[model samples]
Target: MSESQNVIEIKDLDVRYGWGRHSVQVLHGVSLNVAAGCTVGVVGESGSGKSTLAKTLVGTLKPTRGTVMIDGVNVSSVRGADRLKLRRKVLQMIPQDPFSSLNPRHTIGQALAEALDPRHADVKKHRSVIAEWLERVKMPAEAMSRYPHEFSGGQRQRVAIARGLIPEPTVVIADEITSALDVSVQAEILSLIAGLRQELNLTMVFISHNLAVVRQVSDEVAVMYQGKVVEHSPTAELFNNPQHPYTQSLLRAVPGTPGFSIDPGITEHISHENRAIA
Candidate 1:
């Protein structure tokens, strides 16, 4: 996509945990560009820095080096009110763990209302809005009075989705929102997100370890390994013609694929090859 079409642009992003001798780098010169009204899947194994990148995009974690530009604003450099404004209006995130993201003390209505932009003229009159969003996520309006524990995992995830979109943000970052659910439930949640994206013309960054799930919702895919994006391409192109050794290993590991197996020896061999290439 052209520069004008890009809604999110990251240049040489680096993230580290701790400081001094204890510091450990998580993202090394990671870069990506996501076009407006498109979905980009960030796929990798655990500790591949996928979640770290998601948090950086949402401004929850500051990058150690590099720039994260969201809709022309440098989120990493913003502070105080500017950061808050960006989070509330320009970007929103649906965390991987829905149960923990929602406070058990708060009712569903209260949780949803908290996410609504306070700048709205009728922010106090958000009951109708909450109900509308609940229904939009395929949940009953009565769910508003219930707490997080009262809902099923899928239902809670739906609530999480509602909360993320309630503010009508320009960008939505979903970090493994369906990983904890059953296969059927996963399909339902993915369908809901796809429908909402169509309706809102949303620009999204979908983070997941499941390549198949990512392929279902993304227009493009970026494959990460050991803190670096080894390959970035259109979803179909990546699947059909993965250029990097790490990308090929990832595809081979997917269940039901041609070489799928539970053999640890095979997995170890792939990992060794990937490390050598890196």
Candidate 2:
């Protein structure tokens, strides 16, 4: 992928946790490209390195080897102010665990304001943007003063989305963001993301174990297995005719017809993966 064209690009990416004797390889030379203003979903079972990839892209977990280019800069090499500059404008991560991701000490609005005014600008300067995002995420502006525990799972996820987008980032990495909510709520969040993508012109990487959810929101889908991208194709093409064994397994596990019941088997598989990650 051309450096100028991609919002985020990973080439021969390898990530390992621990060191020396305890080291375990998590991502094994995985490579992928995310185009500007597109939604690319990464699907895999637990221990498959989905979160590792997301964190690596956002400069949270640096890859032990290979290259991560965010908006044409090699993020793995940049540090301090330079690294912060790259991440602040180019890429952001919406963590899968909203409760942990959100600050319990601060009000929702305060957190949003921090993301909007990272340099400690006057809150008055960014109040309009904060209110706009609150409305966009379907939360009342008054909810800004509320704490994280006061909100339901779906609402917390909305707050997380609002925080990630408040900065108007060019790339968003949503790591299994819909897993915490009920199906109905999941659909609402999906629609919200779709709307935001159009409105913000965002390039998104949505990581999920649910093929159904990925199908609903992603333009292209990449099936990951054992720390590698097994297959990638346009969403419709991949759902209709998956090429990889894991991809076929994932599709077969989806329940009911198109727009029907999400398969229980798929949920079980995802649950299993979560345990592995934990």
Q: What is the C-alpha lDDT of each candidate?
A: 0.86, 0.81
What is the C-alpha lDDT profile of model 2 across 1-278, one tens digit per residue? 45577777889999999999999999999989888887898887777788888888877787888998877789878888887867776678887889998889988888898888778845567778888899999899888778999999989999999999888887888988988787667767777787788888889999987776787779898888889999989999998888888778767664654322345554454445445535
Model 1 ranges off by over 4 Å: 118-124, 254-278
lDDT of 1 by residue, 111-215 (tens): 888889455524347989999999999999999989999999999999999999999999999998977886667767877887798899999999988776787
Q: Going through the candidates in order, what is the number of backbone clashes in each?
A: 0, 2
Q: Worst ten-residue run, lDDT, model 2? A: 257-266
Ten residues in sequence with the least summed lDDT for candidate 1: 258-267
Error of 1 at 20 (Å): 1.4
- Superposed model 2: Cα runs more than 4 Å off: 1-3, 254-278
